[model samples]
Target chain A: MTDIALRGVDGLKVDYLALVRRRRLYSALLLVLFVALIAGGFDLADSRNAGGFWSGLSQIFDFPVELVREAINKGAALPGNLWRYLPAMIETINIAAVSTLLGAVLAVFLSLLSTRGLARWPRLMPLFRRVMDTMRAIPEIVIALVLIFVLGGGPVPAMIAIAFHTAGALGKLFSEVNENADLKPIEGLSSVGASWFQRMWLGVLPQVMPNYLSYALLRFEINVRASAILGFVGAGGIGAELRVAISWGTGRYDAAAAIFLLLFLTIVAIDQLSSHVRNRLVGGH
Target chain B: MTTLDAGFDLAAAKRDAERRAFRKRMLTFGIPAAVLAYLVYVAIAFDIAGLAARARMDNARILLADMVSHKVHVTRDNRFDKTTVAIEGENKGTYADDQWPAWVVREGASTVVALEAGNVVRFDPDAVRFDIPDYGVLEIVQNRTGITMTMPAGATPEWINASSSRVTVTRPEGRLTVTKTRAEVFRYFGGWELFFFTLDSPFHGKDWAQLAALAVSGERVRAGESNLAAMASDVWNNAMWRHKDVAWAIFETVLMAFLGTMGAAILAVPLAFAAAKNFAPAFPVRFGMRRVFDFLRGVDGLIWTIILSRAFGPGPLTGSLAILFTDTGTFGKLFSEALENVDRKQIDGLRSTGANVVQRNRFGVIPQLAPVIVSQVLYYLESNMRSATVIGAIVGGGIGLLLTQAIQTQKDWEEVTYYIVLTLMMVSATDMLSGWLRSKLIGGR
Candidate 1:
């Protein structure tokens, strides 16, 4: 038996090499396409009257000290200004905050409908799920545009749009959590013939609460950045200033670059804060 | 018997309390339910279709073609022979021509061959010179004044206010078509000529506000009102109304994302290989790579595009490069997790195959990851379709240029609606394409 095993007898293995052998050479060759693209982009960039890299860099920072000071001291009007963007920024966060609040309130109701345990209305679950799916699929911008016209410019339409979307997404997320929850507490309550609400309140709600809170907070962060740009349609926000600056052409790029930096920082900070909270809460549980 | 009766009675009371609490909770749930139902009702009652109709209506440029059916006589300025060219038309028409511009029209069905309306003096703003080949047929339309802009129905006054001559556009559903009136019976509003005479005010800086204000009043040229019919027509007629470019720009934007994501994948695949704990078995390497992924994903593609655009120069190149850098970080993290989940028995089998280190990875690890890596790339490509437009706006490339312009100019909300529709269409198409490609590429699990 030992001599037979030493004869290099491997098990009758499947043809593992078939995939590579039958695979189109292009599958592996796809990497070269990227190399070519990078090279091509660099060349096109190089060939354009595009100033040399040093020159482009130099031009970006060439904001004459005198010019910047002039803009700062004189204050701004419609075309060439910076000071007016503040109110819009504040309004953006306000819309984002109010929208999140509204969405969370709606999500609570949706979550109840979502739970099979509640059995709130036996026939409505499938229809309600379809409604949620459609809402989630529509982009926020599309909702904003349609609502803006009906509501007539302001943060209200934007809030409404964001709220609907958030509720849908949060509802879906919360339902999955509810479905995955431990049934021990509910079962223990039910063994005594306790009602469904009593079981859910003591069981499911508590279990899913942490994930729900974490989700809402993260959503608030996303809504804030999106709200900032709604002003392009005159909905009122910091996005108005951004639109104004961008419209002025390459001349005003630096100002926009500055705004983008702040927006980026805000998102990063929120993500870190939310993640930390979620970890702590989950760990404790 | 007496003790059992007391225990049963206590159990019955407890169960009754639980049932009562459940009933109360169910009753309270009605409040939120009513609110949701009301909102859904409101959504339907609001008439989104009518709103879309109105948005398309307002995008008109107020066709000046019929109202100013007058004529302009372009003549060389007598004061300085070489410098100023003069056009003789009605006072309102001429002045409007100067503030806006008149498309070149000939007396007959010919081109505006004999004349240039604005002067060529160094100080005065010159007209956009069009080289007409012959007096075949030149219906003078204005030079690219308000490139068709799309506004959402929700557009505010801030979005509406825009430069008279420089129209910015955006992405949405339908095209907002504005034809610079092929030069008609129009003259400069300020003077007979389009330019403020260099001979007269060569060095003097004209008060810019009065001129701009004069330009916008009186229906701002009273272009034709467009509904779906107007929009449909504009799609074919307007210079900026072409859908192919919009479609292609969207495609280019998607391509930029794919390239960027691929670039990220290339950089990431190697890093992910090392980052996976199973492969690296080193805490520091894995942690560092994980941090890089977190940081990359944390900043959105919109900001990344802008920042990279600044670091690199402008154009599609910057947008693509941004996609690459951001994708590299994200794909690295995602791919690393996928890499770590791979089967270890395959590694053992690869070793027994007398495979070298490289061959072992090819034979063992790669096969396990092929479907997953491709799936991720396909998914990110789908995501980047929308992201690319937003990013493109900051960078001044792709369809986002139209999106920025439409919203900023507030000339037409329909165009904005059109672009949004197009984006959804683009995403759906790509989603379908990618799904098919993924299934085909993987050839099943």
Candidate 2:
């Protein structure tokens, strides 16, 4: 009887050990494969590149050095350059801010229309979801470029393009937040014979408002970057100015540096500000 | 005394409630009011009123129409007395003399174009004639002196714009323009012409059923190659559409996103450890690393792209590196925060067992961080696909470069539509893929 009990325990131990060994081996193999993939990808990219990675590495800092040196040489004009581009910088911010606002408002409707149980027409939920997905799938540059063709080069094209993307992005997030919301209020509002808009406004909006704001703020930061990029491709802003400055080559790099500094500072400021607000909003809850 | 105290407390509660109500009321009205004011200002600043004047409805109409339909140009060069029929008036799409579209027939000196909506345009050696269904026939003749137009009718319509050097008659179905050197007529048709196979290919005009039948048959389209192979090669190398180049561009964009994202994640892992307070005992190292990450992120991808493009001279490498540099900062910050949040008990448990620092981190910390790392990296991977398109435009490498080039030409709206559809597919595919991977790897988080 003692020998049989000992054999049973040994069998169990052996099986457990084998399972762990297999798991470890699988992990190791996966790691090796991952590393190999990275190395292979690097080699492929290097080969396809116009300039080889090794040769480009040395010249990576050349532009920045020249930019810095020129800025220093034209240190006296730095303030003037910054001031001159201030309006363009403001336009960039305004694009982000207005798009965020418009997108958030649009997202509120889309989220309400798409979320299960919360939707006005529950059957059309997938349709609305697909709409948002399609909108989100399209890159802002695509829309901005096309709109720039029709609307001409300006902030409006960038603003509309960014807003279109923002609506889709924020709508997805807003719907997710809506899913976790307390349905008791909505039920109670409906019990009181409230309209769909009233039920949503009075019940659901209050619950999801903080989260919506937090996500919208984060999106604003992203949109700022997007708007600037759109501007680079001819939609108007500080990015267009930066392009012009950079294209002028060595002599005008000072202006480019000034614009870069402004962009950097603005981005950092927004990043810090949004994160702070978001922490308070999320943590206070 | 008890009644007085109760009453006083009730009064104080009522006052507090009233104050709260007032604040809520103010907020209900104030936020929208503020938004409306801001929008008004933005409207003025962005010149919303002027936009109506500057919007160019004609451009919008052209873009919308061209995206769905294509036009074939039939020109009779008076100077050379030679006629040519080309799709979108491109040299690559020009038809050989023996094989013009059936709608366009050359009878001796004149070429007659049968347009839709009962509109017919005939391009002669020295004159162009347009026969509209409702309106009478309009004739424009190019003489040695100049161009002269005779509008059939009671009055000259606004659609016909005649100048000394040129005469243009525009209609919904087609357009005819007569000039000193040439008489041209454009006939509009729905659907993209020669998308799969150009006119030069043997498979160009074959229907799907015929192509499929031919593809399976033993007979070869070209002597050296099979029918299927010949068809594919023709489509892939189609000069007008450039399907092969577009496919390559799409791959390059995806490659940029993958390499940039994975590379950043790889590079960030070690740096994250150095930045994490629990892992790094030294404050200066953590502080410096955090600052470096901040500097990397603060400079923005735009700046990084410009700088990298200068070094790499515009390619996927520059775009990838730009993404790598920017995302490294983002991953470092996110990873270090995650590292800081790691449960110390796990490490302590490993340490209690005869594990060194390396072993403890490998066994305890990495397991805990794996899910967060995987989820974040996958999320960035999806987003980075979109970024790669934008970056490609700046660096001149990917589908974005193709898209911008198409748009810049200002005539290839159909090609632009193709690229847009492809880009949308690529992005959505990445999104779905990343979502699936995340769910699989992170257990449906």
Candidate 3:
């Protein structure tokens, strides 16, 4: 009996060792494949690029250093430049704010329509979800450029583009939040013969409002950056101004530096503010 | 207790509750009212009323028309006395001498184009004639003394714009324009023209079944390759749509997102350890790392893209590095948060098993953090693909460059539409792919 037990234990040990060995081998192989992909991709990119990666690495700090040196030399103009660009900065912020507001409003209906168990038309939930998916899939720049062609260069194109994207993004997130909401209130409202709008407004809205706001706040932060970028492509904001200033090159480094400072500070301040509010909305409440 | 005092206290409490409810109701109305007022102010500030005047409905119409339909241009160059038929009036789409659409036929020195709705345009040697079904034939003659146009005798129709040197006739099916230098007729056709193979390709205008048969046969469409390879090369290298270049651009964009997201995640893990409260080696180190992350995050991707493009001279690498720099900060902050929230009992268990710091992290902490790390990384990877396109535009690379170029050309709206569709597909595909990978790896549904 002791000999039989010993042989069985020995066989089990061999099998366990082989399994461990195979798992390790597979992991190593995956690691090697991953490394190869990265290395190969990098090599191909470097070859196809106008400037090789290694060669470009040394020159990476040149532009920043020059900008700084020029700005410091013309430090007196910095404050004046900042003052000049303030309106443009406001325009950028306005684009973000308006888009966020419009997007959140649209998202409320879209999310409610798409959420399972709470959809006004449950049979068409997939349709609404697919529409949201397609909308979300489109890059903002594409829509912005297309609208710019029709609308001409202005804030409207950027606003519409960003809002379009924001609605889709927030709709998906808000629907997820809706899924977590307790349905008893909705059912009670339905039992009381409340209309669809009233049911959603009275029962569902209160529960999901905080999360929606938090997500919208985060989206607002992202949109601010998007608005600035859109301006670079000629949507009329600080980014457009920045593009012009930078294109002027050496002599306008002071102006560029001032704009950069403004953008950086604005982004950081908004980040801190929105993040604090979002934390309170999500966590504290 | 006295009955009167108890009743007074109950009434006061009821009054307080009613007032609070009234205040809450007022707030609900006030908030929306404030929002509406702000929107009104914004509308005025943005000059909403003036938008109508600023908008170009003609451009919108052209864009809408061009996206789903193409125009074939038949031109008679009066200067050279030569006629040409081309798709979208592009030189790359000019047909060879032997090739011409059935609707257009060359007779003697004149090229005749048959249009829908029984309209026909004839480009004779030095004069053009448009034969309308309902109206009599309109003629225009071009010579050294300039041009003259003659329409139906009764009254020139509204669709025909006639002047001494220029004549333009617009119809639902086609348009005829006669200028001193050139007389051209554009026939509208549904669908994108020369999408697969250009006029120069031997496989141009072949249907799918025929092409498939040719592919399977032992025949060679070109000197050294099978029909299949020849057809593929022709389509890929097509000068009009540039399929090969477009495919490469898309690949580069995805590659940028891949490299950036992975690189950032790799760089952030160690820094996250330093920044995390429980995992920090020292207080000042954690503080410094946190500040570094803040600086990186505050600079924003736009600034990083600009700086990197200036350095790297506009390519996928610059866009990738910009994404990497921005995401490093994001990943650092997020990963540190996740690390701080990790269950400590597992680490203690590993320590009890005589595991050191490395083993403790590898065996205990990693298992706790893997789900968050994987999910966040994958989510960002999907989002960064969209960001890469925007960054590509600024940095002069990828599909964004092609898209902007197409749009800026003002005549390539079809190409713009194609790029937009491709970008949407790319984004959706990445979203699906990342979601699938996340679920597969992290066991999240």
lDDT tens readout by residue for model 1, A20-47: 5556566556757758876675555434
Q: How well is each residue in B18-134 modelled by candidate 3, as lDDT tens digits? A: 999999999999999999998998898788899999999879988999899999999888778788898999999997767888999999988889999888899887568889988
Binned by DockQ into CAPRI classes (incorrect, acceptable, medium, high), candidate 2 is high
Output the lDDT of residue B61, model 3: 86
Candidate 1: residue A269 lDDT (0-100): 74
lDDT for position B344 in model 2? 94
Any runs in candidate 3 off by more than 4 Å, and if so which? A1-10, A248-251, B1-15, B133-170
Cα lDDT of model 1 overall?
0.57
Better of 1 and 2 by DockQ: 2
Error of 2 at B272 (Å): 1.1
Tell me the docking grade of candidate 1.
incorrect
**Candidate 1: segments with Cα more than 4 A from true spot:** A1-20, A24-26, A29-97, A104-130, A145-158, A178-204, A228-265, A281-285, B1-241, B274-300, B311-315, B337-356, B363-376, B407-414, B431-445
lDDT string for model 1 (B160-196, tens) is 2334443221112111112333211222232212223
TM-score of each: 0.54, 0.95, 0.94
DockQ preference between candidates 1 and 3, better one = 3
lDDT of 2 by residue, A96-119 (tens): 999999999999999999998899
